[model samples]
Target: MLQSDVPIRVHANWRPLDPGVLGSAGPATYSRNFAGAPLTNTWYPIALANRIAGSDLAPNSVDINCNFSSVFNNWYFGTDGNPPVNQYDLMSVVLHELGHGLGFTGTMTVNNNGVGSWGGGTAFPVAYDRFGVNGSGQQLVSTSLFPNPSIALGQQLTSGTLFFNGTAARIANGGASPRIYAPSPFDPGSSFAHLDEATFPKGNPNSLMTPQIGTNEAIHSPGAIGMGVLQDLGWTFTTAMMADDSDGEKVGCCGTGKSAMMQDLKMPDAEQARLVDAAVELTKASVDQDDPKFYEQLSQSLMQLKQARSESIPVEPVNDAEESRRVFQPMRLRTTTPETERISVADDPVWRDNFIKWLSLPRRDRLRIWGGAPVLAGEFEHCVAVGGGGRFCCTGTLVAPRVVITAAHCFHLGCIGSRGEVYFGLNSNNPGTGRVVACKCVPHPDYKLSTDEHDIAVLILDQPVTDVAPCPIATPSQIDDAFFLRLAGFGLTETGRSGRKMQVEVVVASNNCSSSSHQSTFGCKRDREIVAGGNGLDSCNGDSGGPAYVDVGGRFLLAGATSRAAANSQRGCGDGGIYVRIDKELEWIESVVAAEGLSIACDSEDESEEQSNSGSVKKE
Candidate 1:
């Protein structure tokens, strides 16, 4: 609780963001050219503004998309140092995001050409910007030293050396100014808003506000410099010598693996929020909620959405998914598309460098609908989210202690080496909150990107995983045209959310082209592929490289791997999905395990005997 005459009211919500952005906050309301003050349009994050104004100013104060942590990757909720590596502290990230909402940002920014500017390029510095200065004590905002926005000012922004000139903060910093982040080429989201990471490295009391966080890192308090900066920004303490940092994440940095640069987009405040939301809304089937209150809200939103024509809303097409050369890249032209079909961006591969492009679309009214339901906690343990090389996109399943099976297309042309980390978890609600295991991946020799033929890969883990049992592989004889498959993935759904594990059952719509019922000329018969399309049940983004299972008795056997949306489908997901017939590739799968000098997963004599003696194959 804050000791204010009124109170600080903050409004925040959970929504999917780009891979790295954790959360974002800032002024919901800005005062332009104030009559009395030092700076014009000095922006204040909503939290601070609320404390002074004594009322909530906007619909929501902060927009947090730590959705990656809840159900996705390995983010440590504990402040203790037990998980020594790859753990991104959840509380630390929240505090950092909250810190921005509470005014830990500056107005300084540099363009691609290294020209610096402040006050949103209009001489209107943020409230925090008033105290900024260079290492030599020259105020960056002072007209006497530099123009409002100039190459000279830009040089100072990326000089790798800048500081906050706040008196209290300087005093807290041992009489020297508090350093700020000013890298060249200016990381637009991180440059001026955060403290310099090096000068106040992750163990310092002032590191909570830094621009990048490494894995396994956590900060429990906001540090001394944070309070000092707040003090300099007009916040008063009842009795202050140094001030209390009961404002948590106290020090510089906590723990982590690699330095990851993350920033939440300023919400409701940026002009781009709606556009981003529109982009997100176009990709799903519908919204869902298990909680009563949220469900009720969603029910209302659904009705309102049903009455409105979605085509009325203009969406700026963003080619975020232009890459990855999606296997189902063949799009059904609109002229022939049924009017009932909703737009789907599921086939788009645009998940990278997209945080800033996201606009604040309504969190509740989004056009998300999932044909699948959330799986119970303990089920589908073998399913995983696969990411590496700075891209957090596909999904995979554990087939053995050290082997993961996913789509060959998930990786680049040649699986020359280990691709990236394999995440072991059911959902990803925060930025990084899943148990991670490193692995080396090799795609099938016959895999073809052009026709998506033989789309399969065997990812061999660097070490064995003992906690989760691998999914048993089905023998070639067990699969046929009469197939009912279980689809599981940590991918996007109708709720405008991804990274959560969802399960759906779909029937084999078509297998061989010769018997008629062949879905499309785009090749249902192309390269031993199996087709499964449901009206609203199928896999989408983040589910690539995932497994499709078939039941034999009470056990589910791995029968296929998620390849892409059906080439003939109207929407990306929910209409249908293509799967690589894994039963046909059993020989190749074992060959990879044996060649890698690792014992094959789930092919042991005991398991085979247990299965052979078990009941006959059953369909769902």
Candidate 2:
């Protein structure tokens, strides 16, 4: 339940006890940042990277595990608990564990045999491991000085004097490197991974992450140095988030809390058991019915029921020529034929450029959003063209053989004639080649035309597309760990108009309205959209409704769908734009597909494809 540049999803569960652990959480997977760019390779927590791509990319970014057994049950759920003495604050522990999962622990590990290695056996170090140094400021991971997997690195791990070299963290620690908890004994889980406990004693502002929790203590926020390290990790906070550490001396996030009473009291095991039992009883005590906040948070579960209008099925009505005038006989057959013809005049970039200017990028810098590399032949076949007679108004992704996901804005009569044509393959010149006519369009119930919130729609296709394997809709976890967004579409190119599909990688700007780059300048609300792009790369004219993908391992997952130029983009393409975070629309998508007589159950064969030619696409 945290967000930085984008929406972040972390699900928590009460699980059986793991010995000597109260709670634990970390990224489910990790990956190399990118290829053919920049510095030495760096690994990123896959779930954190997905946050930059789209929301709800998978079920959750970090799977949280907390002990809930009777043996580990002496806990206070919130600050208002009675007789809170001897009780551990669950919120404080949760915050501390979340801090680590978000990005704290590293790959460095020390073996008992006087040897140490980083990367957890990977080829590159994680982003956090890059800033570590020894007592004399020697880089721990560098082969030039401290060769990896050597006695030198091991000595540094147990040196009792390691420092974080990040400039931001140093500044936060009073212009000096923060002392790390590298004890002589070298505990694998604690050594070299935390702030020295003595330096920031219990209740110190930066003690929340000191590797230990104390009874009767609660940290209100991540202390100053914690924010600094996260800043060094490339996370930017809003003004309010930054304001948490302004006072400095508070016993909050990243700081120590109340001293360990049990550690000092030396009570007998029987006495400790009695105290634990009392704490458990406290949890079961009745709540104060008059507590307004309690009642507010305890709102009853709700279920909304509505009757939908019966729409026309697969057959397009020839009831009126104007309404069905654009209907083609392809709807009458289950198969299509390819031809050696150019794209239709309506969709031809060259033809459209003669008058209309934008597609995803606005026409005036208004419509489809870019100048990017042309896709390889037969690549991204599931990213189809949406419109008729080979003339397309927007782009879409095939989620199922008979289901296509597109922007709600593209569901109008003028845009795609309500029931429009869908074309597959790189060239849509011949409507016969893999063209699947759409029979119905279903827009989100809460879709807002004025704000573009929930700017998504579903199109039920007339026939199944067997050749092109559909993309798997991303889950919340996948979205949070995405490092980049692959914008792919049959859009306008720099040469004015090429029917070939184009794509470019856009950096995620913000995932929510509050942090949107254009929030102040344009009052742009990315509430329904995810902001991404910049540096001369973007989805542009004719790229509307395109698929924005995230590569999970080697498989490309559908993270979002191109909607329009970002609310803040004055130039449309390069300045960055917005895309519909398709992940958040999973429920509506499943419902629509089900209503249309399509079976797209998440874990079913509909989401699976052969791995030989097309990249793998899975729901998980």
Candidate 3:
């Protein structure tokens, strides 16, 4: 039932650990401690659950150790109800193991001779140790033999006398207490870590969290007793109650109340209002018919609310100094074409004062060009050539230190040769001086060659580039027709192919460009593609995958990436072309960056700063 935009990273590669050293399928550890401070509120349990779902912390790392021996090869990996009798259900095993990662297992570590400790002698106890007791009904932490509370509980677990003494668990298990597994000869990974295998045997209704798995068995739910144990150990449920009415009073399992969960989330006013209305409607439906589906709907609403809240949190660039340098300082404007107005610039006082000071470059260093006009020396530093063998096949923008955002067709066109190299700061025509080989190129999963629905791909570099700063991506609300964008790339121009990078100011014609051939060959999606061109300015070949950037408060934010040229343009490359909107792919971009452990520079300044610094330039 847990849902969120953030992905829980799973590392499933084969490890060569001896089976005798680690007995279970895997082990789970918390990346960060949720034991104290702000984490101790009534809504702590729900917030913890959400944190586990979206955590980027190292302590949240869960390692699943698998024995890849030939004996385990016959495992059934499908979801069908019927399988071969000899096949083991891999899904059920994985579900149980994931439960351990989600706070089912204890954090205590014990030695061979029954000596125990936790948190490296700090003796900190997790929620699980609070309910543990000895055979004589003495609470483990209250025992006199051990002065330290964590050691006392660890000794109890090592002694094989620990049992869950919570009233909820006892009532759920038919009046018998649930015992923790602890045999005479202590097992490091197996002992003190699981439910008593004898009491909750495999194939038993409550055997999902037990130590062993039997043949042809499937556990769909974590039975009534299992839920009780989890509830006792500081875990909250989305349902109205943890057990039957007789066990305890119905509690608000989402948090202390719905209001608390809402307080934790920061969403737009419109989205928050909509979610509130949906929750109210679902609550009324559940009150009327008691349908289980209502619970799921409510859960999804909460998840969506949480996701909106996370996305609303603004990201800031790592280096504010570098970000300030990339801001385009307007000088003078000129009407380049009947439909185009260019923001013309020369090596003026403002450029020398700002550009030279920021980049620490020699004042005498003159701007150079291949076949186009001179560009601001540092304005398009984030632009790079994404091809191999010192050739500029296609252009890309570095949104992250190690990630390059580009057009999917760049790869489809075979422009990105094998062992592709990403040339950064290729200001001159020469591409040899600065280049990094790409480690992987991941196209959008839904990218279609025929229609180009999601014409985007992310290239991960072998290492991060340190010379140039990355550009910030625009939000969906930021891409309007009122603003003109600068299209920069090392692509072909009116004369011929440009060895150096060039840029031109162009206005957005129509967000949705339509034609008979374009409609038939590629579906026109206004929200995902921006049609912009005017005054003999357009993105041509070799420009595929380059950036269409808008100057927002001096910062060059990426609004779109070059997708394709419109088919019906009479001027060929002069008319407006299609650029994949970056805002539409923000979520996918963030997810991929998080999964790949890449750092993207974001604008972290407050809204007031962005508003006060907004500058105006001539419209195209």
Candidate 4:
């Protein structure tokens, strides 16, 4: 049984002029000719059998002029087998036409540039509702008569309102050479739906309208399969077979193999035009023999023509924002939090990069901070100096087997050539104590130096280690400021101590203050203090990308990273480290981790919730 899925209602009052419509050679003359052999490798649709009112009409040839009762919709089928003058098969032709009618065939158009290119400029045709044939007052012309000399086989139903989207019109009876016209197809009251030029097969040489058919064969043949025709329109097979397999021998459709039709217009159009134009100009030059100026004039004229056409047809810009947006997903927290705890990430430091007086006003801008006391911390761990001259560096966490998570900016430029190592599971002043692996840095694409959008990075290790346990990534539900987080990183020991990767001593800080950074409609943020060193709580130079984790329900919930600080701002080793906001971007981080096929290490969700609610107090 044929599997029917997307059923479309058949149009009522569907009546075809002929089973096999013939075409003329040129548009100027009306002539009669014998019909070609019936297309056998295709299927045809008769009226719907269930919808027929009375007699059953077998699939047979009928007079083209006669119309009988149809089975389904408003179709008419001729039942008698009279070998009628212009009669033909009913089911076959309707099936083929219905393919176009039901949006099965593709639509496309090709424009010929007489001397520039081998094939014409091709484009997908728009199936507008204006060109439908099921309208009243349509003056159907005999297939024997060409509509216009240039437009060999076109139909014009409406006058002023109908047109072939701006082509010249013509009268039947072979008055004018056939030319495709838009006037008759777009009558003011006409509904030209689903009629597109691209539906026709392109590049077929043997056609009624093709020059090869000539006047003698034109009156009896269908037009060439131009641009968009498909065999599936009438064929019973779900897919068109590339070749005959009767002998069990396989053959390709085109000469030996069937390949999908692929025409890249942008890649070859300009080059093809250039070559053709040059060759034609050269031929003209040779024809002019001694006159170089004449050949130059011809070339210039062709260039001018191209310029004029380009000026007439303006190109529209294709919007790519939708394509770009498809790569990102909406972020949300899985668990609910109290509205009171939802706030921004952190506050700016008090000191700012003040503007200096200049003779000619040197163009320079600096960070300007308003207020807030510096929260400080004592010591740090698992951090390192990245670049040479203290220009750039960041903090990181050794999370998994051969995996470290850090900010995206620290190793972006340097890691492209060489990766920095991770020093973890040890306090400052010692090296090579923890599992040290060569880091393989992966920076997020959205990471930018200017905006610092996705300032997160992942470090792949040459080998996995088992010494230290990794931290669990916070889910949408676990993002809360009720649990104060622990921060550790390799930053400067003091303000002036630059080269040393000194670890900071731990200090407890409130996740309370409101920062202006992480305030978005989607997720909540904690602007509280981080790992401050001297006067500040959290992180410094080597702490920029370091993790800020809270012990929630016995599991570590990473809340933030040390991202920035005020210009020349100084605090205790634990008091002044500004961290990159992590909780607000957990979804993004999760996507990246999932894409890399890496699993995060942490405790169970229920355990975390129970522990947080129990109010378990701990000393760092």
Candidate 5:
């Protein structure tokens, strides 16, 4: 047995054997001191040993028995007399006998006439008896119906067909139940206690515990069925102990085959246990209706475990490339940006005045845009209204079915206290169209009111929004040199209350651009912040946390979140505003999504390459 922290006492003794029985190995005797007591410790059914039945002082033979209550230790091999060879491996025999001492043998005692009795009829059935069933599916202990219960049970043990009813054993056997040894003409110590020799012939991988051992054959480890039977007998084991040969062939004691088996069995059972525990936890916390992927992941882990045991192989480490491919990738959406010659607002003073007037108006009077019309139906469907009831405190963008990205400051009133309900498609006045309550809100840990460096938070919806698809996020490389962008939101506009969603065009401004107060503001950090809107169109008070989109290969990708209006601009919504760059926080976003088990697909280069190839083919 493997070394354990628990201490146990074992005693070994040897006596001279009769030469006539030299071919036979001795039995492993055990006594249950605390009969009927619960097995709470590693050691139980303490073992005791008697003299060897083989030739006296034979170097090729070993006569050692261990306490099943204690771990097997101190294996000593004999060097005198007929020394060990490929035919007889002293260590292999010792381990096999030790397995017998550890509850592998049946508790039934038989007489010359094949009559049997168990524990002097004082104790309940042992662990081995629990799985024994006759051909008629009747339990072995129910032999009271016979006039001579012992004789009837003995006859059954010698000739009747018996099956093991352990669930794990059945599963391991490919749904075919496992059978026990029961040959004609009752044989003591070998009949009821072993697997039938006829069923598991010599060279059969599962013949470890059979009644007879073949000459010149060394069986090193218990096969898969053997391990499963032990499990049925309440013997706990690790995945390594349960490992088998890849080809399902028995391994001999002397070659590299035995060494390889031992090596494969070295995987710590604790690691497998941890995996099982994780699977259980995921199962308990999973919402089957909300995420079917949870079940998929759990199934994958289970399959790994099954593969580990069936093939006697260790769990393979996950490949980074494979893992990257498995992660969710966001889908890019088609944009409606017009390709016609555009009008520049650089010299348009009248439009600038109109934008200022729109911002200066009352909240009830200001529209989402100065001269802009309602957003083309279903254009910015990923945009959501953030707040409770028919009122919205801010705007947000959905990057995942259950995840919404918004400003950290929006939760100033405490995310829970704000009691917000995210509206996925709020183009109309109907609140019932796409409303979902926020289940959780997570803000960037480094976010601060003073610096606003990490002004981002993600809201988890109570239920996934399936009607509208999420918007694809932009990478730093895709948005760094962007000269123009489209801002969309349900914030205040010239039309008042920003009742309907609206979009406007904005131009990227210089980094040094400051507000009217002459304070160096709108400082654009390549990774953290972006400055935009030198044009007449700009975000107003209610537009904070809304999306700033850039055209990437004719698709609209979310580049940033509306952060703040230009402090130096004559009107807060007129000149330029600062937005939190999404590319800067991609790592944090990915981490949070993974930790929460929220699925969000990211754009993949492989998909882009495939599209490129298809387009080239079309062009040809």
Candidate 6:
């Protein structure tokens, strides 16, 4: 178990102990520092990245130096020239310790997760016997190891397999599941394997409970090795979640008596033989308890018991609504066509004054700090409408070039021809009076309407209006609740009153919506009700497709869209109209534009210039 504050110790005598050539890793020699002292208050691995320098006497073993220093609080090894011990040996030792700490003891095999028969198994064994063999002495690999096999706890012995990656290996000793790792492949002739524990987190590829290779030259954790030794000794360690007063180290419940588990086992040959006997008994007991036939029989018995325990099928009581409703037929629409044709825009009274007012300069001074138009280079001005519904909504300004950028959602609600014609540069009262530039609406595909998230849209007009050019669009930014917002839309001026009218209000409202659970600020559940009833400042039905602007550092940010009307709302919308939170869906918005071959909102170009200039517009 890992301690929060205590330092684990490594002995001073540590040195490089690899038997094989550096193999894939080159022969790198490092200067030694701590040679005579035992490392204290620090953890060390059984195998390390450090190298052992050979002395004149012995070519096999090398000495490590542990320089006592108050700076580090104890002796430690590093490959850097300053460290005393041979860095390579220290790395190996640490690796060994990590294994024991992660729990790799007993007869469990990591490959198939089967118990290995023991002639004599050490804490970190050199080989495996878990693979059952045929009568002719041929090795029969366990069936569980195959991927997508019928049996659970499959075995995998191949090296470089992601199942035994190093990162996943480190997740032992109570770590989260599905750990990703890159495993080190085993060298040729190495027969070690890993063990998997049934209790380990699901989808975790490497588990010490599973068997793994034991290379004397490989890097392994010494602490893990020590822990395994203790387990083999018949002592179990229980980690403590609470703090401990003594030593301040995390407390753990372990054996306390003199005659602890495996206390009688001797070392050398006698110890090996005793361990083998214990392994056989354990394996026999496990096999007897969990034979495959026993499980199949148990499952069948349980099924039968469930069937026998079922109660008599009950009859549903008769309900008047069910009988009456079942026989009820829906009313059909009658075909009575005798209506006068509606007047078109061409026949309507021409209102140039209203158009001039709509095209008047927006209240830039009252805009949100992070929102509104910024100055652009050259002569053209741009106009941007931020709040729009669905995916084709967003804000942009017309620079010298006639361009209008409202959100993609504004145009996304209905398909082209099916949707209402877009009218821009109109005054707050008469939005349709502005110079009508028949629009080409384009919406991003990734935009989803489920949560009203990622609502961005763009519009292209037939020509640009030179008199009232679009304002330059600001860059996207993150805005918190502290940001103030403003809104402008041709939505209903009041709740529940939907009509062909536009309302522009520079109200200082909170940037964040009230409650996200409802999908919109106005969406109330059956059990819950919003308290804002009398406030006249609520979003209404007509506000469904408008921009909510946030002020960030003098920039006008398109923060949200009016999305949902209050639940149980009358035909005419009422208080607590909801708006789509815009900041949360920026990435999706950008992706839609990039993937659609459309230029960014801030790009300097306008295809609508010709249409915008066609109608002669006088400045307000």
lDDT of 1 by residue, 132-248 (tens): 777787878777688866888988777877887666676688877788877776766577668787787767878888876666566767777877777666555665634333444
The root-mean-square deviation over C-alpha atoms between each candidate and the true structure, in angstroms, is 20.5, 22.4, 24.7, 28.6, 30.0, 30.6
Better of 3 and 4 by TM-score: 3
In terms of lDDT, model 4 sits at: 0.31
lDDT comparing candidate 6 with the true structure: 0.28
Candidate 3 runs further than 4 Å off: 1-371, 427-429, 513-517, 520-523, 606-620
TM-score of 3: 0.37
Query: Candidate 2: where are CA atoms >4 Å away?
Result: 1-5, 16-20, 35-40, 51-70, 80-83, 240-620
Best by the TM-score measure:
1
lDDT of each: 0.55, 0.54, 0.50, 0.31, 0.49, 0.28
Each candidate: how many clashes?
61, 57, 8, 116, 21, 154
Once fitted onto the true fold, the runs of candidate 4 whose alpha carbons sit more than 4 angstroms away are: 1-393, 412-418, 425-435, 475-479, 498-534, 553-556, 566-577, 605-620
Provide TM-scores for the models: 0.41, 0.39, 0.37, 0.31, 0.37, 0.27
Query: Could you give candidate 4's per-residue lDDT for residues 1-620 as a string of tens digits?
Result: 11123232333222111111111000000001112112211111111110111221221211011111121122124433122333333432333333332222111111232111000111111121111121232322212332211242233322222222111111121222122212333311111212222221223221212211111111222322211222212122243332333454322111100000111001123433554566445434445323434433332232222211111110110112211211111110021224554321222121100000110122221100010011113223334323222122445765555556777666553522245566553322223233345556777677755544566777776666664455555543454432234555544322111223332222222332333233321111244223222222234444556666655655556666655542223322222334455545555654655566665544355446644533221211
The segments of candidate 6 whose C-alpha lies over 4 angstroms from its true place after superposition are 1-420, 427-432, 446-451, 465-478, 495-534, 552-557, 566-574, 581-620
lDDT of 2 by residue, 1-620 (tens): 24444445555544322123345444433433333112334554444444433433333223222222223457787755232777777777677767665566566667778887776534566666777888778777787787778888888888888887766677688878788778776664455667777787668989877766666777757787877776665455664233234446221122111000000101223544554455444433467644433222221000000001000000100111222223211100011112332111122222222211112222121112243245557778888877764466577888888888887777642456567778777655334445556556777777655545666888888777777777876655566565457778866543233345666655565343543333333223444456565434567756677798876765777888876664444443455557766656776777777676564423222223322112223322
Q: Which stretches of candidate 1 lie over 4 Å from their true place?
A: 1-372, 389-391, 413-417, 428-432, 512-522, 601-620
Say which prediction, candidate 3 or candidate 4, comes out ahead on lDDT: 3
Model 2, residue 591: what's the lDDT?
73
Which wins on TM-score, candidate 1 or candidate 3?
1
| Candidate 1, run of 10 with poorest lDDT | 311-320
lDDT of 5 at 387: 61
